[model samples]
Target: MKKKLTGKTALVTGSSRGVGRLVAIALADLGCSTIFCHGRSEASCRETARQIESRGAKAVILPAELSDPAQVESLADRVLAAGGVDILYNNAAVMHPWRDSPEELSFEDWAWSFQVNVFALVMLTVRLLAPMKLKKWGRIINLTSGIDKTPQLAAYGASKWAVDKWTDDLAAALAGSGVIVSRLDPGWLKTDLGGPNADHEPEAVLPGALVPCLLPDDAPGGSFFRAQELRNFSLD
Candidate 1:
């Protein structure tokens, strides 16, 4: 049987591990033609590339420190040069160290979070939008957090909030344009950022995580999907 994304290409940021890694592999399993795995270093993405190749999909390792704007631009340049992608999964994010109080969060913390979580995401999305628009088909999934009332991680939460806002606004702008932009909250999984005590395992993000990518072109943009809620869900 043929797969869902047989002719499609994708880019999953932070795909070296955790939720990004799982999502990239799942896309490959769905028959994506090429999946770009982004990491801070090429070495970090080797395993993911191997896994994707094993599934008969080509994996390209694109390394860039998202915290740096120049690196983000370089990453985008590389992707565009490679002919862009049919799907863009903004899954990588950084969490600030928990502070005793919200007021204790430093300027650096907020800046760092915004740079990687918000600015970098926006830059990539904007740069890639043209290609998707030209083709009149695309999927943009921005991973967000359900974090709330936890002032200890204010910087992280605020950055994710910005992501939510960006998604909503972009969705509006891209409405009826054939390119759907939406948000996906992977829940608190036991990943590096989620810590060992997280409620769910990283694998729990599978099928549900791919929902946004598989949506019909007419599906509304800006929809929010929760991976945990879609557990045991069927894609067929």
Candidate 2:
């Protein structure tokens, strides 16, 4: 695609570390000047901003607990004030109480998953939809997983499945609106949540993770992509 996002603003959550961080840097490298390098820390955000700026891209820092509706609203507001969010990377997620069987997983686990995975997404999407819709162009990507079929990580899988369905529904609801909705599975990267021994590295999938966001506005939406399966679109 073109350097279409050069002047656009992109916000990436949990971008202070790992895959989210890599995506932020990658988008900057692709000539997107304004990127919101978001995390839970002022210090980390500054550090992320420094790195992006070193690459000659502008970075904004907006921090919030992804699960909190009010915080998500505030984040959207900050992005709007910064000239609206053109791309949204919902890359942050929770993998709580590992190894707890479905029945053994506490109500708290369920609540927390929905809070971060589902509710916060709805809130943020709701807030940004108007701006994106008006601009007649935007990209929204939700990071999901392939293990929704696996026995392990039952709760995490279930939550991502929710995200998958939600993304598809949103795409259908807004067909022809120019706002694209898609889901990305970053191929089980080795992060704090993915564990140290995981099969993939965060950097390995950075380019593919950026693709869904960079898809042309006329391209199809509501599809699922694993980084390994997205080589067809790689600019490299």
Top candidate by lDDT: 1
In candidate 2, what are the lDDT values of residues 1-236, reduced to their tens digit? 34646777788888888888888888887778789988877787787788889988888888898877788889888877877788988888888767545677777777888898888877788788888999999899999987755545676778898999999899998799999999999887788888888888767785678778878779888978788677466564
Model 2 — TM-score against the truth? 0.93
Please give, for residues 1-236, the per-residue lDDT of candidate 1 as tens digits: 13888889999999999999999999998999999999999999999999999999999999999999999999999999999999999999999999999889999999999999999999999999999999999999999999989999999999999999999999999999999999999999999999999999999997889999999978999999999998977866
Number of clashing residue pairs, candidate 1? 0
* lDDT against the true structure, each candidate: 0.95, 0.82
> Which residue segments of model 2 deviate by more than 4 Å?
1-4, 149-152, 231-233
lDDT of 1 at 232: 79
Pairs with steric clashes in candidate 2: none
What lDDT does candidate 2 reach at residue 4? 46
